[model samples]
Target chain A: MCIAPVDEMRKNHMTMLLHQRDKTVQQGIRGQPASLTGCIDCHVTPDASGTVARSDDEGFFCTSCHRAASVKIDCFECHADRPAEMISQLDWKSLNPINHSSLLAINQQSFPYALQFRLETRSMALNQ
Target chain B: MNKIDQYRRKFLGAASAAFVGITIAPGILLQAGNAATAGQGVSDAQRWGLLIDTNRCEPGCDACVQACNKENGLRSIHGPKTDAQWIRKVSLKNRKNGHVLNMPVMCQHCAKAPCVDVCPTGASFKRADGIVLVDKHTCIGCRYCMMACPYKARSFVHEKLTDQLPHAPRGKGTVESCTLCVHKIDRGDNTTACVQACPHGAMMFGDLNDPDSAISKQIKSLGSQQLRKKLDLDTGVRYQGIPV
Candidate 1:
């Protein structure tokens, strides 16, 4: 079995949770899926009537998992809390790794000096 | 003026509703007690904290990991992998910017912890002062806490904790993660293994609760972000963007 990448270990763990949380949403629990795999799957918009799915709603198949696991979830945090099909119109590729390296480099140099002080203090303690 | 009148009407409606039913939401009530639940005295004067600047983080050093293992009495496994890592170099590539964010992964020590909630036996909990931890003796090895964690910071003991120092105590079957060096912290030591092992000044730890604390002040002025805001974990750990 391919264990998750060390960097994405959290994602890997969430995937297992989603599977384990199967069929438990309506029983008065709140274990929603993590936003790692796909945002649209969890962050669905309301129906055409402008009503969003509730944990007790029949169509909120996704919320069911979260409810069963008793994990309180906020869907709008990752997916656009608008409508279901509209999510497809959003750019999911921005979440991919295409331009991540360059962004990391640009943001890398600006770390603050206070962080430096903590590191130095620890170094002295451990050495002794 | 019609637009202004419309806004005023909406505000009045909300204000009236609030007055009629002034019951504070349970979530809000829980928030007040959260600070005290961690079991540490989090005074405004001294809030413990940690910082890992990805720009400065380097791989292959593993000095912090070595020291943590030694201090915690962890045995070296087949790979340099062990469950008691207070720090590990994590490589991240920002898909949007293509920036390689090499960070040292550890517990964020979140203010609102999901891991603590999911633990059926209450083995996992945050101290009053805000250190998230596990009582190994009480842990049943369910790994439910691990699954609930958004940062993937918790680790499982696959084998027995061996070759440990007489003073260092850890073993198998329970979940473990970075304790912010609780033993060191309890002894009034500010140094953590990762902070000392780092040849570069990559990882920083301090009191975020303290207004004058370095990490707190840096977070306010620098605008760092938690790893996953969507989770609403309210993590004390913050990171500056990594350099190209």
Candidate 2:
């Protein structure tokens, strides 16, 4: 569950997301808790067929809420509605072999310190 | 006052000062840490650019184009007109001298970008480091940027894309062009996929503002040409060895 209350999130999530987008896309400030990718990673629910996506399914988290509110969700139109695992596997090292550290640094900034530490430990355990 | 009273007042003053310092210490440290990290943000002092030596570009070579497609996950849908091509090889021949030159053309990343000016939603914008990109979330698929662009470099996605790099998020209906590998640039990578793929050493990527940068030095010594210099767009990309 997110840090915010469900009721508050349901009412003001869009405002939070918009603020996050401005900070991230415009000002290049990332790794905040309100990132869209983080939201999808946490809240996405799988349908009966075990497919989790934003559209073409009524059970998806964003779709269900937007459908209920009758508000158009245009983010899915251009962005992946699911988590990174559901998308194509990206070989980050191959993409920029020379600057993988910088890539990792940017990714590190995307999450809070506690989550980031947990993720690092999990990855380290997996690697071992 | 007695010596004990004066000492007590001095102790209280010092203790209050220590308390105030302790109260603000974390915030001060955080600001310092942020200043160190915030240096990663694109700065106006650096104008990232690319220089193509057309004379060195092999005519049959499509390595750069192929690499770009692979890097960006641009798949051809059998629609020659609609397929997104971030970069393409163009062969130019001098009419009188019959001299032929081949060069790759992509987004110019202009200082005075027409696409940015014409964009109704302001999704088309140039970064502080001079790489122009489409904020896909707000693009609205208007295609106004396509019309405004003089280079015909931008393309509209005709279909949905399932296989997309997390770094390069593209989708149907949004107008996209050569980002100059913005993901790489933002991560402080000095090279682009096309620049790395060019086997003939035809492409050079570096900071244009830095006098010592390879592209800047090359432009100064060899004399590079912008595609449409008349527009005074101050494009970040330049080409050398093209017949005037």
TM-score of each: 0.52, 0.70
Residue-level lDDT tens digits of model 1 in B37-144: 143223233446677787787644555665665555444343323333444555544344555556665788888898999999877877645678786546788999
The candidate 2 chain B region of ten consecutive residues with least summed lDDT is B28-37
Fnat: each model in turn = 0.00, 0.10
Worst 10 residues of 1 chain A by lDDT: A22-31
Model 1 chain B: which ten-residue window has the lowest total lDDT? B34-43
lDDT tens string, model 1, A1-128?
A: 22445467434655654543221111111223332223433444557997666434546655666666776754322223334344334344332212323323322332232133224332211100
Candidate 1 retains true contacts at a fraction of: 0.00
Chain B TM (all candidates): 0.74, 0.83
TM-score of 2: 0.70
Docking class of 2: incorrect
Runs of candidate 1 with Cα error greater than 4 angstroms are: A1-128, B1-46, B78-86, B95-98, B242-244
